[model samples]
Target: MSELVEHVDERDRVLGVVERGEAERQHWPHRIATTICRDRAGRILVLRRSETHSRFPGYYDVMVGGAVDGGESYEEAAARELSEELGVREPVRFMFKFLCREGTSPVWFGVHEAVVTEPLIPDPGEIAWQGWLTEAELCEVVDQRLFVPGGRKALRRYLESGSGSGAGELGAE
Candidate 1:
């Protein structure tokens, strides 16, 4: 069976649940929970997506995340994605959310953050290359590499809002 996602409206109201593939194929808005993992020294965790992955294959991403499962809250999904993708089980702090409509489809994206104190055991199916980059290095790579679009936008927003110094405001679409 395919994964399920919570279909949401523009205002982020849950309408119903749908297969993740169908939701994307039909351009239905859904929630994606992304966690920006940071090391104790404050460097961001970055990874290259697996080439065979469904979305944004082989692209570099500064965050690790996925679709929000049906009936799951953003925080729940954030923690789940962190553990699933990076093999870390750290507590995630709610950051901010925004409507991202610039990529494959529109998605209500919830951004979270966690300080990873444990070594990562990245999922091979989801991550190809992984590393920790300082904020300055991240800025350089974001411009130098073919980064994931939604993640790029989120990174921009994240930086503009003081690079996770505080809870960011509800961002514009």
Candidate 2:
């Protein structure tokens, strides 16, 4: 059985539950939880999507996340994605949320941050390469590489929010 997602409207009200693929194909708005992981040294954990990934193949992303499952809160989805993608079970600080209109379909993006204290074990199926990069280095890479569009927008918003201040900067956690 395929995964189900909560289909929402422009104001983020749940309309109904739909298959993830159907939601994407039909351009239905849905919720996605994205977590930006940073290590002790204040470096961002970046990863390249596997070549066989469905949405954006072989693209680099600063955030590790996915669609929010039906009946799940954004925070719940973020935590699940963090553990599933990077094998980390840390507390994620909720940053903010916005409707990402740059992608194929509009998605309410719940942006979050987490301090990773353990060794990262990236899932091979979702991530092809993984590394830690300082904010400066990440900026350079984001400019030179082909990044996922929604991720790029999310990073821009995160930086503009003035909360990208290095690691251990958990606010309101």
Candidate 3:
């Protein structure tokens, strides 16, 4: 089935809806929900995309996310993606939202957070591997440009949002 994705404007107001594949192929503006999963120890879970996937395959990603389907709110999409991709069913607290464009691709990036309280059974077909890393560890790799473009952008925005304090500092985060 072709997934329907919400297309939004610069202000994040939905302009219309389009097929997910076409949205990607044409770089249409869409809404996506990203969750930065953490555990009690404050380590964040990262996933490596399956090599067979079409976009950024085999790249590391600190955010587990996906398109906001037509008729779905960002919160709904966020929770759904966490369960589908990482087997997380805990309550997720929304952190913030922003609109960004990289080259032609654009997204209303909704950032969320949650302390993962259950075992994550990643779908092998979508995730090649998964690991937990500290903010410092993630920052090191992100500085090296070792993450998917969206992940890098999202993480940078997250760090900036806290002004490198609060939850932004790596080792102390």
Candidate 4:
């Protein structure tokens, strides 16, 4: 059976529910949870998507994220993505929401940040590998376009929003 998720308009008001695949095929605006995590030393956790991923396979990502499941709030989905992809249930603070317009991967994206004390354990199903990078190093990687194009934009927004310094704002979409 196909999982259903809330479908929304550009303003992010729920229009109805639809199957994930159908939503993607139609480019319906759905919700996604994007999260960036850091450790005590303030090194950011960067991950690479699995080669088998349906979208952006084998692409580097500055965040761990996934589609928001049915009935899940953005905050809930952000935390869930962190737990599912990194085995960390740390508190994720929502930064902002944006309508990504890069290409076919359009969606209402919620940016979040979390701090972890435990070691990160990446799920092989979702992530190919994981590593910790300093903020400067992350800038270099982003400049190199090592991450998915949309993901790179999100990361840049997150950084400019001052969320990396423990300040985050919930910007309107």
Model with the higher lDDT, candidate 1 or 3: 1
**Cα lDDT of model 4 by residue, 1-173, tens digit:** 88687889989999999988898888898888888788888888888889998778888888788888878999999998889888888999988999986645578888888889887888898899888887777876665655777777787787677766522221322
Give the per-residue lDDT digits (tens) of candidate 3, residues 1-173: 89899877788888888997787778778998989888888787888899986667888888888889898888889999999988779787788887767623888889888789799899887899998987777777765655776677777777767723335543321
Evaluation by lDDT, superior candidate among 2 and 3? 2
lDDT of model 3 at position 173? 18
Estimate every model's Cα lDDT from 0 to 1: 0.87, 0.87, 0.79, 0.81
What is the model-wide C-alpha lDDT for candidate 3? Answer: 0.79
Candidate 1 vs candidate 4: the lDDT winner is 1
Ten-residue region with minimum lDDT total, candidate 3: 164-173
- What are the models' TM-scores? 0.93, 0.92, 0.88, 0.90
lDDT per residue for candidate 1 within 1-173, as digits (tens), equals: 99999899999999999998888889999999999889989888889999998898999998889999998999999999999888889999888999988778899899988999998999999999999987777876786798988888888788777864432332342
Q: Alpha-carbon error at 147 in model 3, in Å?
A: 0.8
Q: Which of the two, 2 or 3, has more TM-score?
A: 2
In order, what is each prediction's RMSD in angstroms?
A: 3.2, 4.4, 3.1, 3.7
Better of 1 and 3 by TM-score: 1
Clashes of each: 0, 0, 0, 0
| Candidate 2 ranges beyond 4 A from true positions | 166-173
